[model samples]
Target: MASPQKTSRKAAGTRAAIRRARPASGRAHSGDAGDDIGLDALVGHAGYAVRRFQLWIFQDFIKTLATVDIRPTQYAVKNVIGANPGLSQMAVAKRLGIERARLVHLLDSLEERDFVSRIPSTIDRRSHALHLTTRGKAALAQFKRLAAEHERHVAEKIGKANREQLLRILACFT
Candidate 1:
């Protein structure tokens, strides 16, 4: 992985943009005290490192999902429905860190594709309970396989121990 972008200080209370450079040898180099570490120190700022890593992982996800005709959010909603049949739309939205209103559009698209169904919530007439259709179940299985491949690729890039530690530390922020 590349080092974090250059880090600078514009003011006492603000941070400057982080910048990174690649060596001619094609190796990643994090900044050290002797080097102009600035804000670009990959080891110095966890957030910067994580942001770059997230973009890397997302790119991998996009590549792996290209053949599926479904967005990551759509797959996640379906996965949630598969795991918790009859879950309320609001609950799915909350679990996915998305707005309930946004979820409605996603649900509509899925329903149109016959991947899922929305039934009236037994607990609340005004609410909806989500369920995956047979097609959606099959799609989820395929997605799981793709996800496993994605994870394996990432693990290979960042060692398994580092990957596990990274996930554990990231969960703390959430």
Candidate 2:
């Protein structure tokens, strides 16, 4: 019979071998699976399949947003103003998570297009209140419709349930 010490060593070696033989569920190892690394390095080291899939999804969103002639940031600003009529410039900036100075430039562009107006605030004489013009409201409506269509398309690509779950996960991140 084998010595007890040798038998224990043999059992440990067999377990290690079994673990090594199993395929990993996460990122496949090209080499050095035990290497300690940061998230960026790990994502970078991952196979191209996952990265390509992510890029394709982003590309679709970019194309959809482009169709309305509004970038994602512009859409966000318009949505904030639409939702909060008579909101102060500072308030809108805060709600949209943009700097006051940057919001000014965005408001300027919208104002030039007659999509929005900044009037003296009734409550605060020192501040200007934001409002969407009829034109602005119409534009927002159009953009919203387009967004709905885009969302449907994406949902079709990835099931509606999955899209809802994705939104929930993203909300947690924000």
lDDT of each: 0.79, 0.77
TM-score of 1: 0.73
Q: Over the stretch 17-114, how does candidate 1's per-residue lDDT look in tens digits?
A: 22334233334456544434333345467678778888998888878878887677887898889999999999999988989889999999999988
Per the 3 Å backbone cut-off, how many clashing residue pairs does candidate 2 have? 0
RMSD of each: 9.7, 10.4
Model 2, position 92, has a per-residue lDDT of: 80
Model 2 Cα lDDT, one tens digit per residue, 1-174? 999999999999976654554444444456646532223333434455347656766576668878667756677788888888888989888877889999899889889988899999888899998889999999999888877877888799889998898788668545
Model 2 residue 130 CA deviation (Å) reads: 0.7
Which regions of candidate 2 are displaced past 4 Å?
A: 1-40, 44-59
On lDDT, the leading prediction is 1
- What TM-score, over all chains together, does every model reach? 0.73, 0.64
Error of 2 at 61 (Å): 3.9
Model 1: per-residue Cα lDDT at residue 20: 31
The residue pairs in collision within model 2 are none
